[model samples]
Target: MRKLIPLLLLVVHHFASAQTKDERVKIDSILSVYTGRSVDGKGLLQEAITLSQQSDDYLLGQLYFKLAEEHLATGAYDSAGKYYPLSLTPLEIAGDSTLLGEAYIGMGYVLYLKGDYTQSLNYNLKAEKIFRAAKANKLLGRALKRMAGVFIAMKDYGTSEKYLSEALTIAEEEFDTINIVRTLNTLSVIYDETGDFKKVDPILKRAIALAEAIHCIRCMAISYSQWGISLHFRGQYKEAIGKYRKEYELNKLEGLTFDQYFVYQNIAEAYFELQNLTLALAYSDSAMFLAKTENAPQFIHDSYKIQYKIYKAQNNLGKALAALEMKSQYVDTLFSQEKARMQEDMKVAYETEKKEQLITLLEKENTIKVLEAEQSKQLRLYLIVVVVLLVLAAGVLFSRYRLKQRTAKLLDAKNIDLQNLNQVKDRLFAIISHDLKSPLSSFHTVTSTLNQYYGQISQADIKKYLEKLEVASKSLEDQMKNLLEWSLHQISERKLSPEVFDLKEMAETLKSFFQLSLEVKRQNMYLEIEGSIPLETDREYVQTILRNLISNAIKFTPPEGTIWLRAKTAGAEIVIEIEDTGIGIASEDFSKLFTLEADKKSIGNSPEKGTGLGLVLVKEMIEKMGGTISLASELNKGTTFTLKMTGKQQKQAA
Candidate 1:
């Protein structure tokens, strides 16, 4: 036993040494999973640098570029900008055009993060140059699309539209359905914000279909969510609630608490709109509770407003007044926090500026001393005043010549800038011209097909065609959403709709729509409805939650997989479960799947070619609805998702 103890101790020491190495591996694995977010990329790069010496060859320049990206994502502009140039130097030495393009993109992202919109465009253009030169049209299109987002953020909507349109064309030519969905969503948002409601509906509907077709549940869910919200804005509350309920159920199953939140929140509003005070009050409480729990200011604001109105309507004067008081308190808290952050930023800026000014003063003084000493030396040689004057005249001529040369160089650079601007303008025009044709063509085809085959086409054929059209239309709708979001983010013209409608039916209807596909895959997709679960929420928002989950199940499943969905009540909460016999999540990826704040994004498994922001949107929208969402999965086994929300459905279940 004594001899074994010594051996065990030695083993422990060796294991400890290897444990550090194991930790480094873990960090690398985490970063690889979170490739969607720029921040995760940077953290991974730093860890790599720390673990390996400078002499170690582990794609050092690539690491630096990723570091630049991470900094850019978190709004660290100066640091990103500095590192980008350094990274570019190494890439130039390597002469890898792909890497060079990546560096340019990094620089562009940093400039955008820094609020240097005009300069950011220049950097993106530089990236486009490299990508185009390499004949990487897909990458070039992506660059252009990113540039559009920047333009939208800068409130250059017209320009954004042009760029997105061009990008969409390229995506279509490449058969990139993911990019198609992306562009369509952006365009839908743009149209919505501009009050082009007539244009938004078809776009959103089509986007939902595409997401469904690709088995990208999150994308579909988002489209449904927007569809419901858009319907609510149009005063289609009944329809909106239906969508919200569906989203609520879907999100709950996925353990996407944020999305579940939105479904409940909106369900409450829909009930209120319909003058169902009891349901309305219940939903409002749920929404507020979720908002508070999630620490979401905007959703919280919405919850309070609904409560205030509910109290006032009930003629509870004391409660109504109290609600208003709470409103003020909430607003003040948000303002105070913003004010404090700004103050701190300003203080740091002032200190840095002061130090810089002092350094400049000292440098100028030292220069003056050098000039004085040189002057004394010249004075000692004053015996030749003629030589001194000649020397001065020559010095002045040389300085003048240099100034002329600098001016000419500046003019040359300006001309190049102007040429680049012209090229961008021309590209924008070309994109708009081509893009305008596609949707018009699609609409024309849809109308013509419907009209021409109204009597000749069989019911089954009509359904199939509609399904395809739905997918196509979603592509357009998605573009509009992206466009609008981009523009809104640019100008910060924020608005939150507090409307309600049932979302559950829409979700059920969607399942039926894809019945054929589900059957083809031999997956038994069943919904267990406990009751007439009505919710007051944006139907579109809720739809997004459901669609994402369902589609996600289908995507991950192999042939003959089984998917089960059920909704019931537990106390004050309504719970929905989605169990699937498909490729289940590993224990390690579980947290990454549900933690909305994580850098993780959709990878090869995600068909939508997304930036991985949709889940975050789903999570956020669900929370806004006042619900909770969760997920359980196992490797090669299957995944089960659960969603819980506070709403009138609880009473029905009881």
Candidate 2:
């Protein structure tokens, strides 16, 4: 035994020396990657993990922890979760509290992404406790920051801000530039969400400077992005674009494809707000391309939405419809993904419950065995009955809890539907009462005036009265048509039946239909057609759209004002424009023009009244035909309604 002890000591010493040497080499390699001296971070970490398996538990735990952190940084949450737990056992065996806490922190982040806020908080709190005891200020700050993130997700912004403030203080004290920048960004987000815009800018500015000082490209990019968002929210679009461009440059420099995609979207939005549609379209296309390359459905959907807005702004109705279709496709994909995730969560919960129930049964069986040996038969029987009763009670309570939760969800959805229906009902009634009644009363009054003064009135006066009657009747007719079409649209009863139609013929029809109204208003109507333009769309919808637009032009234009109906063929689409020299719309009202929310009425140059439904109906019909409409106007100058739709001739050409 004494001879064996000496031999074992020699073996132990050799193993210890080898472990120390391997650990040193592995750690150095990891540090090289982390410090940017090497580019193969993931590869090196994985190799380190493989090599450290035969080393001491402490070294192995550290390698596993580093790999998990690498996964976390890259957003591979499931892999990070797996490795984080793997790290914990070895770290516990080695009694390394610091690395164990780090594993807990990483696990907390994974749980947070999985929407397990309670578990995430528990893990973070455990990490915080360990770090506090160890006086690891840097690690403690990270744990606190993670806890703040959980509170942020829970929407406890006040509490999140408090935690973030403590984290920032610790980071500052330790001169941890990375943590300082991160905490500042998180703090700025809280302030931004709480509508304290005043504080966001300064914090983000400081964060950006610190990140720049540290030469942290990613950190600087994040700060710039946040600063751009702050400016965007404050309506400083030009400055926002500038900041987003800076972010784009930094992300591009770092080859951060995903980050560049988001930066492109931000720049597009800022340009869109500034009315720079060309640049907006360019940036949006870039974002869409990146989104497609990444195959990220959510990013694709968002990019399509941005493109839709840009196309709508440019009056490219065909492209806008295509963008909307793409957006809708991605929306459906996202919904399915969410549903699958929810089902997965449910499956996980069911498995957990089954395991728990099995554990309870085993525990009860052991308790019964003990009781049978140590107690009387009657006491053992009583314990068995009590345990069974408790199990039944728990089952019943769980069933009730699930039922209540389902009931609440159903009630909330139904309530939302009811509220939406009510809003539609109210708006419908307002349109009918105000718009329909005004024109009908005017028609009635004009006819009665003519009947009562027929004999007393002169021929010229009678002619003038007839013109007034004609105008009133026409206005009433258009209003009734719009109201009926809009009602059909509301109930989703409208369907498109596309047929080939001549654009010139449609223009002539509209001109004839609005001839009397235009003459009454003394507006010169011009028809400009480029060759033979054939549009493939629902004829009635096209006619209705044109009629309403021409009617608006006549109504808003002054006496002797000019109205032009222009149609031209552009590749596979026909572009139509209804231009009028009239009192133009204000830019502020442009957003509300095509929506049902445009309730405020505007009187035209002839003091003609409008229900604001004409443009709304026009817009809906345009979209129904897979087309787009856009408006350009300068107050008191003129307004142009531009429409674009696919042309049948192009299909023939192809």
Which residue runs of candidate 1 sit more than 4 Å off their true CA positions? 1-44, 51-61, 64-120, 150-158, 266-280, 309-317, 324-654
TM agreement with the true structure for every prediction:
0.42, 0.49
Q: Candidate 2 lDDT, tens digit per residue, 1-654?
A: 233333433332443545557677866676666742235666687666655543555676777688778767866565566567656755775678988998999899999997889999999999999999999999999999999999988989999989999999999999999999999999988887778998998899899999989899999999999999988877899999889989989988999977788888988989998999999889988998988898889999889887876776675655765776677567667656655654453454355346545644654565555556655865555465545535543853475357346534744664565566556556766787777787678778878988897889899988887777777777776776676567556645456766787879888877887787777667799999987777676787888888888888888888999999998877887889999999888888788778766554643344777777878888887776678999999889999999998764111100
Q: What does candidate 1 score on TM?
A: 0.42
Candidate 2 TM-score, true structure as reference: 0.49
Choose the strongest candidate by TM-score. Answer: 2
After superposition of all CA atoms, the RMSD between model 1 and the true structure is 30.0
Ten-residue segment with the worst summed lDDT in candidate 2?
A: 1-10
* lDDT score of residue 566 within candidate 1: 82
lDDT of 1 by residue, 114-178 (tens): 57788788989988989888989788888988898797787677888898899999998998877
